[model samples]
Each structure stands twice: as structure tokens, then as C-alpha cells.
Target: MKPAPFLLTALFSAAVSAAPATHMDTKAATEAVSVYYRNPNPDRALKIMQTIIADPLWKKDSARHNLSVWAAQILRQHPQATDKWCRAMKQYPAVTQDETAYFFFLANTSESRKCLRNLNISNHSKTYIAQNTPPDISSLSNISPADLDALWTTFYATGNPKAVEKVLDRVLDYAKAQKAQEKSNHKNIDMTGVAAAWSARSNIMQNQDIRKIFDTYLNRLNATDKALLQKILVQE
Candidate 1:
């Protein structure tokens, strides 16, 4: 008479629910719920989520705001799932900014940038988040380099090159500032590292071929530097 996995998951979820909704507990709960959703049994995940939601504690706990976000993400990931969770996200405007950004990234298909734009995010913060995301390379494998470059350009521009150019200029300026700071703080800064950064900036400014620029930059690096850069770029 072993308990079912879903029952175990539900019990664990209930234990989490009983804890005081501290910021740390909220984060843990979000992650636990996400793991449960990614489980093969969608029904089980749905049941666990429903149990958590039905609990009177969550009904009044403002700290569990992020739980709704995780629920939306879980629902979106399921093939047969409805848009109910997405609608719920919209209803809860107090949802975390990161959660909102993640929702657009997950749910929107036309363009991740377009999704962000529709969120009415400020221009300054948009680039920061978008660049950090660096489109999933695997998903883009079928996408031609030219198409990717165009997509990236369009994303940065918000469909307007003139407006995006300013954003690019600011990005370059920030890079330069960072380079200067690194040189000043670390006297042994590698020259090749500096050159690669400049080359990347040049590529962006010229709207030149990004892949080619990356290749050229990589070729110019020393063996040690190349290895280091590869380690930084390539990840699971």
C-alpha cells in the first residue's frame, strides 16, 4: 500500500503551504510547483496546484503572488491546457516583473520582443532583459543567420530602427565603460579580450554579419582565451 507519486507531491505541496509565506518560502514553493508541473503526469501536477490554491492560507497570503505565475507557466507548458492561467496572470497585476517577462517569453510566438513591448516595459530595461535572454540557439538552429540578424535588429528596434539605434549606442557606451573599469581595476587585462569586445561593438554598430563577426573574433583570440570564451558561451 504505497502512496501514489501524485499523492506524495500533493502532501509535500501541502506542507509547503502550511509554512509562513516568507520571501524565501515563496521562492521555494514556486520552484517546487514548477518541478511538479514539469513532471510527466499533468493531471497530478494540476491536482497538486489546485490543492495549494484551494487552501485558505494562500487565499489571503499576498506573498504567494508568484505562485499564480508558476501556475500559468505550468499550464502553458501542457499541450491540452487552456488559457485560463494566462488570464489569471493578467488579473493579478501585482505579479512580479520577472514573472511577467517570463510569461511573455514563454507564451508569445511571433516575437519575444514584441511580447515584451506589449507589456509596455520601458526602453532602458527592455534591452537589458532581452540581451540577457540571448535567444535559445537550439530553437533558432533552423533560422537562417540573416533572418536571425533581422529578427535581432527588429527586436532591438521595437520595429523602429531609429529608436533602437539609440539603445544600441547606449549599450556600446556601457560596454566601453565596463572595459575601462576592468582595465583600471585589473592591470593584467588580456588585450585579446579587449579586442573581441571592441569587435563585437563594431559589428553591432555596422549591422555587419553577426556570425562572421563572432567567428573572426574567436579566430583572433589566443588558445587560452578561446577556451575561456567557449566555456562562458556554451552551456546546457
Candidate 2:
């Protein structure tokens, strides 16, 4: 009996998507930050964010915990208020120091860089980051896909074949798992159904981030790996 392709696709997609997602902020707050990234024009992102946070939802002390990265950026411009910043960051557990540091890193403002340097990150985090500043390729698949994407994006900020290789390897790991499903299950039955999709209707290469890496690192992959990618991507 043939299983309809969409059902498998949807089931696999749902499994992949079911990974615990980082909490999100209001749509307005998200757009404000995305707007800045797309354009990066002078003060517009900041001004837009400033306006968005002024919404009544943001004013309530109880709701302040949901403040997004966009709101945090506007707050970054305020005069040094360590106590306030501490309290606010404490409240919004979702708005992480990693997000904040990465935001400043992307912003590339002198003040923002200073803020990153001052972040109260632990020594363990500092060492892990220093070791994996470029991010290790061999271990990419061990983390959640969201973290994988974030790390890939960070490494892509300064593109290299090594980083691209890591991204492709992570994708390949799952694809191979799909191929090796019969063998992988004996080790872990509870998650075998969800850890890897049997097939992908959507070529992962279609994703812009992944596509960029594919285009950049196509030659670096061996013939066998390339063939595997073609299968996973549903290409002839």
C-alpha cells in the first residue's frame, strides 16, 4: 500500500517543528527587529521599535516579561541603567544573553559591542564560545535545529567552506539517518519515528540559508555525499 506523500511530509514536518521553540514576542516586536536587519538604515529600526513597545501591552508590569529582542534594542540605547536592565532581563527569561550579545554583534555599533563585552556570561560559556567561535562542524547535529540554524547564521555572517560543511553535514546526518532507519531504531525506538524524516517533499536546499551553503560548498562534498544530498533534496 502506498502512503500519500503529503501525509508523510506533514508528519515529518510536524516532528521537526515540534522541537521546543524559543518563546516569541508580539508580531509587532518581531517585525521591528526584522525590519532593521533587512534595511539597516540609520535610526529607523530603533524608532519603529520604540513606537511598538509603547503599546499598552508593554506598559503593564505583568506583561513586561514578554518584551522581545526589538524592545531590548531600544532599551540598549538608553543611558546605562544596570539595575533596570538586570531586572528587565531577569523578567523576560526568553530574551537571552546570547540573543542580546548576538544582536549587538550583528548591530556592529561601538556601543553595542561594548555592551556585548560587558555581558555577564559565565566562564564556561566564554570558553565554549571561544573554542567554537567559528562553530565546530563535527558537532552541529547534536543541538536543536533552532540552535543549529542560529549557529549556522552566525558562522555565515563570515562565510567559509568549513562552516558550510558543518551545515551540510548536519543536514546530511538526518538524511542518512532516514536512509538508515531500519538500523537506527534498535538503539532508540521512542524517537526513531521523529528524529529523521523518511523523505522530504521540500528540498532543504530551497531554504535560503541552506541554499547559500550548498552553492558555496558543493564542490567540497564527495561524490557519495552529493548523491545523498540529491536524493534528500528530491533532485534527479
Candidate 3:
């Protein structure tokens, strides 16, 4: 009753793959931050950021922008450590222009503002920050398209049920807005909400919690959108 050779090989492979890496890559960091949003491991999360921020890939706007959001989200959980967060970011002087702009926009606290002031952020980014109002993640009523995009990205990054619920709330909000526009006799109603929900089909199909959300909200959608979603759910 010994294990077969192929089974032994598979077990060995699994054990090797399960071993933790010395440093977190971009995808791994993204996942770590996503989980940190819920679990709030300030020390390990900050260490992960310290590791990945040194990589040149993080200088790219896409990664930096997500980092800004993720960092801000993590900070929200640690209200008392705003100064600590600022100190950590100060170590990275090579932060890109896009990172400067996004981080500046989310830096509502005085300590955060001072941290950015001391950093090597470009004058143009400073001007942009000064001229425009910083986005308030706390206020969903005034959430811009960009912020909504970030929310959906967070849901995809973590697959957390809470993240799923946040996206569902936005989807329902968009549906409501679409209906409001239609009532005003607008010829071209924007179905951004429906489109957002449709875009989440693959993610929803893959997760049980997300699938339950899809089911709960299915009947809430208008006939056309609901039918379209039902068709895809069955076919896919």
C-alpha cells in the first residue's frame, strides 16, 4: 500500500511550490494589500510594500496608482499611525509622477500632506493637487468613475466578500442612475452600471460568495439586463 511514483512526485512538487518566497512580487503584494484591508497586519503589510516599492515595475503608473489606493485603504484601518505611514513612504524618493498625483489626492491628513511636501514630487503634480479637490473615499455619493474603477479592481484583487458587496452597491447605484436619466427623457441612457456588472461575469462565476451576490441582485435589474445576464450565466 505504498504511494505510486507519480503520486510521490506530485506531493514533492506541491511541497516545493508551497514554500514562501524571500520577497513579494507585484501580484503577491497586490493580494497581500487586498487582504490587509480586511485583516490589518500593519507590520507585515508595510514590510511587503517596502520590498516591492524598490522594484522598477512599481514606477509604472498602473502599479503605482493601485498602490496609492491600496496604501490609502490600509492607512484608513490604522488611524493612529498616519505619521508612521508617511515615514515609510519617505524612504522611496524614486516614486513616479502618477504616484505623486494619486497619493497627493488621497492624502487628506496633515501628516500625509507634509510627507508629500518633503518628498521629491514634481511641481506640476503639486499644482494639480492644489487646484483640484482631493477625492474622498468616505463619500460614495460623490464617487467619480476613476474611484469606481479602483473599487472594482480591489474586488478582483482580493475576491473578498466585503469587496464583492462594495462592487454590488456600486452596480445597483449605477442602475438607479440609469433609470433616473431614462425618466428625464434622455435618448442615450448611459448603462455604465449594467456594463460594470456584466464585466464582472467571470469573477462572479468563479467565486461562491460573488455568485450569491449575483443571484441576489439578478431580479433587481431591469428585464433586458437581467435577461442578458441570465443568458451568459447559463452559457458560460
Model 3 per-residue lDDT tens digits across residues 1-236? 00111111122223235435643364465455534534556566667666556655455445556556656555555546666656666655544433543553564666566666666666667777778765554455543445555565455334445555555666656555655576576555444454455545645654555677677777677887675555544444
Query: Which ten contiguous residues of candidate 1 have the minimum total lDDT?
Result: 1-10
Model 3, C-alpha of 171: deviation from truth (Å)? 4.3
How well is each residue in 98-138 modelled by candidate 2, as lDDT tens digits?
43343343333455546556676556545544454432333
Off by over 4 Å in 1: 1-18, 21-76, 79-82, 94-98, 106-125, 129-236
Residue 83's lDDT within candidate 1 is 36
Q: Tally clashing residue pairs in candidate 1.
A: 0
Candidate 1: give the clashing pairs. none
Instruction: Give the C-alpha miss distance for residue 100 in model 1, angstroms.
Output: 2.3
TM-score per prediction, in order, is: 0.28, 0.41, 0.62
Candidate RMSDs in Å, in order, are 16.1, 11.3, 11.6
How good is model 3 by TM-score?
0.62
Deviation of model 2 at 176, angstroms: 2.7
| Total clashing pairs for each candidate | 0, 1, 0
**C-alpha lDDT of all candidate models, in order:** 0.39, 0.41, 0.53
Sorted on TM-score, best first, the list reads 3, 2, 1
